[model samples]
Target: MKLLPMFALLIAGFIPLTSAYVDELSNERVFFNKMLEVLPGNWQGKYADGTYENPTSDWQPIEVNYQITSGDTAIIENYVDGNESAIMTTVYHLDNNDIRATHFCGAQNHPRMAGRVFDRSSNTLSLNFVDVSNLQTPADYHSRGIDLKIIDHDNVHVTFSGLENGEDSTRVFALTRSQK
Candidate 1:
């Protein structure tokens, strides 16, 4: 009888971790998947702070390519900046209506963030930090959030927010879909 109570307590402790995404809803997944229809193509874009990323104008060239594989669940985004000088990838999947992504950073840690439509009537997707596995609290640098605004069938705006040099900052990108 004494052992039974301890066993129940241990099980309860593991529940939250195992069910962290319990709030993910099927209706939300349906909408998120619907929105993904616009993603699987190449895009030409420019960063918001193009002058800083490139010595040129504020519209420095960047390339974005989206590839979908493994059925409807997995989506991959590839970013190439300034004639392939910098490259990074983000992998996403749907959990109900909530979308989760693991950003493959060039630095030390791979930060994972979660996203959902800002509002049921809005097309903006806002992703915020949930938890990171390899990051050591305030010691390691990582991205804090991202906002994706779908302007139209061919235009999108992406914003990435990060903790850089112990301060918060953001970078924006304006992307246009490629015909090919």
Candidate 2:
């Protein structure tokens, strides 16, 4: 009879700890969940001035698409160029309670980044390069990082930063949801 009462007390002692752990995990994933909520669609926009590959003063058209994949374990983003060809693909997933992205670049290398900073008030997430694969050289062109800003469900702003020949390159996009 005494053992029954002791076991009940022991079980009750662990309830709060388990609940707190679950709550902590949920809080840690809020930003990732928000991204999954608003980014699964087609977006059309233009490259910001002075960033076009051809060095045009005019804004060049760009398209991006996002879809949930791997049984909702990942989000895949595809970048479409003016020629309507896929230029790059990025896969975003959560690992070790952090948001991580693997960018498959047209430059023929893969750069992995992690989103360690998230601003809830601004709805912004910044991911910086951690490691890479297939990089032939240290100076090879590859994506350096990405900054994602969610303006709303229908609009977003993204800045893709890269390194080319060991020089910094950046492109900014202001995208609106495409009805088509």
Candidate 3:
């Protein structure tokens, strides 16, 4: 029938459109790999009061160290408070250009998030959330997303989003490269 031929043509036409979308995703994946290429070093951090109404000069300093291993295929990011107790360890890598992180939280679950490049430049790489794992539902206790921006070779900023009373609450950190 004529309708059958028209439907087949329509479906055939969509194949190339889908292929183009895949190619775009491929380009985005390359961007995430570029972000990982600049992330291996020890770093220090200070408070970021989002309100901007208070002075952060008197704020506390913290330690955040990064090191790559397994032939530069994995990065271990450790966060330490003033008391010298390492609080969290996040491992990051690229799976076919889709940046992924497994956050070993102090809590029970280690949530994983897939990231897409939110913004990228010569000095910054920002990753927005694409999807998440280790969460059963919306009410689960897990890190829902992360906003990671690598600023230059020595500075980075991060915001970890979690559910607080059924709403999204974020913990932000500003980090600088540590003097060895």
Candidate 4:
């Protein structure tokens, strides 16, 4: 009779724990799938910064187009007015509870950038780039990083920062989604 009470107690405790575990697993899967879905699609936008001699100069911003493969590989092709195309490949995956992406392009100016997705919701996604190589600006001897925040799936705000001499200089880029 005593064994029956002990078994009941064990089963009751186990049920709640098991239920909580299952719920967590389900939530994780849902979040993962949502993250994957948001990345694999066409993204058309512009990039701009006020670092130039004239902040209001009418230089045409870049046109970004991305093709994401089923294998989580992304091909990013960018076009700037009167300039050749710039191509990059980005691989994205989940690493230790964080979504990470490695971006590689053979540009002499910018070699590679590594980033992580910090926050994600149904309508917004934010990414922060940690590893950046800036090979173009030698005089500045600066390292650059990027941060992107998506709003309403159509508007995106991007920031680029240069880390040099223990100081940081930031430039903001605001873009609207181009409708095809």
Strongest candidate by lDDT: 2
> Model 3 off-target regions past 4 Å?
1-24, 27-29, 48-60, 121-141
| Runs with alpha carbons beyond 4 Å of true place in candidate 4 | 1-46, 50-59, 73-84, 87-93, 103-143, 164-167
> Which model is ahead, 1 or 3, in terms of lDDT?
1
lDDT of each: 0.72, 0.82, 0.67, 0.49
lDDT of 4 by residue, 1-180 (tens): 999999999999999999976655454445445545543343554444454333444444555554555554333334334353554344445553444445453343342344433343533233455554555544443335545455545555555555545666755555555665
Q: Candidate 1 clashing pairs? A: 28-97, 29-96, 29-97
Summarize candidate 1's per-residue lDDT along 1-180 as a digit string, tens digits. 999999999999889766654433543465457557888889987786422344233556789988888777888888977575438787888864678888876555778888754644456677888766566667556787777777778987777778866977677777899876
lDDT of 2 by residue, 1-180 (tens): 999999999999999999876655554478778778989989998777333334335666789999998777799998997786889899999886777899998899999998856666777788999999999999898888888888899988777788878678787777889999
lDDT of 3 by residue, 7-27 (tens): 999999999999876765675
**Reference-based lDDT, residue 43, model 1:** 91
lDDT order, best first, reads: 2, 1, 3, 4
Best TM-score among the predictions, by candidate number: 2
Candidate 1 regions with alpha-carbon error over 4 angstroms: 1-27, 50-57, 82-86, 120-122, 133-140
**TM-score versus the correct structure, for each prediction:** 0.71, 0.76, 0.69, 0.50
Instruction: Give me the displacement of residue 64 in model 3, in angstroms.
Output: 0.6
Q: Candidate 3 or 4, higher TM-score?
A: 3
